[model samples]
Target: MMSVCGYRWYPEYTVEEQYRDFNQRQYICTVRVFPDYPGAEKPIHWSYGLGVTVDMAVQDAAYSMLTIMRARHALLQNSELCYVPASQSGEEGYISGVYFDSSMEDPLLQSTVEMLENRDRDARALRMELYATRARLWTALTQLAPVVQTGYGEMEMLNPVRTHLPAHVDWPAIGGVTPLRGPLLPPVRGPRPHPCPYGSQGS
Candidate 1:
């Protein structure tokens, strides 16, 4: 039996808007040729794009994508020859994709993979580490004690408390602090004017 797969493929795309480390792009310039395999093959057509920032690479999420593409290859090849749109835009973490077929042989496919890899590397590098993440986790488990739980329970290191309120008040965790009162300004005195009602001329 012929199997089918639906995935987003970005053919020719342009960046309509861009922001820090991300770009919102649009692409719809390819026509898919689905002459054969229409009836026997379950024709499914859909596309999606993804972005993964560098620091968020916990549990080797990067590998998951490679695996997905690798798996989707067979299904992609069986579908009608089609063009899909794929795009990615976001701060720091961003991944983009284009409509693609089942093989990694396409030049565009190779380039797209390279681009994704580069973005991943940039993100990983910007955050400055892989092991540092592990180390941080290690520290959380082995070192710091929770401020609240003085008992022997495990703890994680947390950032110091930040305050925007008056220094005189106690800063408790989670609860909001009362804002300090400021001096009120006196109301401006304006001249009182007599209003002429009804007639324009005063008799």
Candidate 2:
């Protein structure tokens, strides 16, 4: 019922700094999803908006995360149903609606301008035509349901645009804010020191 989407900002390689597209500064935003969860079959990762500020990038990522959460919540609410991985499916299909209705003839019965001025036979005919048109439209909408799409189509709607990172990007060094040449790795964490039984190390 929760989304695993996480966000990060790279201000050094911003669109404004690299491309000089605009005067205002922007950020290179990245989102990583489904990496650590055991429930997920595979990870979904993507990024967006080199032109957007850091705050805006976070907002966009949050919106996508919420959408995933909603889908998960719906599945949890209905335990009888199972969720399909739209990205992994290969089927292509669409739904069709009803083709014919006698009500289509009503358009042929429209009244002329002369009938409107005279308040004559054509006026009564126009009223009948209008009524039939409304009825037909209502019937079609109420009777027909949208077709269920294939997994690919569902995946298209669900997933965000995939990220394509540029080559030869620089990364910041540990404890330093400045960018250095080459690809960056995740920060390494040192092991926690054992607590002393007596007191300070000096003692």
Candidate 3:
């Protein structure tokens, strides 16, 4: 099998005899597959089998290894090589004479799609929060405009008294004078401040 696949090296095997029940003995065979060159540093795959005879045990181990290679698309089937689609491979998805493990492709694609969806959701939430904050700030500023203008007018009206009164005088301690409180009064003149700049203008 290794020669057919263009590998110059062959599989290595180890066998051991084990005692079984009833004074019987069994053979245990282990096979290790290495890369094509001699003295390869590591074995690519390994399998073990047990049988009454050494030959049977070795054959069993070889069969197990072949099964694994077939599933990985490493072995030729019916004298024809299988091709994997590009979508499944996630890159060049299709190879004319090569096979790959198609099982892992779907999960990789699903994870990528899920990550994009999560990012989109987070961006939309941030935009909504920003819009809400701007709306609340505009509302507060608009509601406070009239009170600010009324206070400014009152200060202007009191300017004369402020200039004539002695510097030692404490207005809050004098008669018929009290601190401004309660609901704010309306502006004495002119139109109200304009609505929020972002809102539509209408007559």
| Residue runs of model 1 more than 4 Å from their true location after superposition | 1-69, 77-113, 120-141, 144-203
Cα lDDT tens digits, model 3, 44-162, are 76777555456556765665565445445445543333221111112332111223344454675655545544554453355346546545655654455566567743423211221
Better of 1 and 2 by TM-score: 2
Clashes of each: 12, 0, 3
Model 1 poorest 10 in a row by lDDT: 13-22
Q: So what's the TM-score on candidate 3?
A: 0.35
Per residue, candidate 2 scores C-alpha lDDT tens digits across 35-78 of: 44356544354333332234444443443333333343444434
Alpha-carbon lDDT of model 1: 0.33
- Could you give candidate 1's per-residue lDDT for residues 2-93 as a string of tens digits? 12333333211111111111011111111121214335332232222222221122122323343334434655444442222233433554
| Model 2: ten consecutive residues of lowest lDDT | 81-90
Task: Point out where model 2 deviates above 4 Å.
Answer: 1-18, 35-42, 45-51, 76-203
Q: Give stretches of model 3 more than 4 Å off.
A: 4-9, 74-203
Q: Each candidate's lDDT (Cα)?
A: 0.33, 0.33, 0.48
Write down the TM-score of every candidate.
0.24, 0.25, 0.35
Choose the strongest candidate by lDDT.
Answer: 3
Better of 1 and 2 by lDDT: 1
As a whole number from 0 to 100, the lDDT of residue 179 in candidate 2 is 42
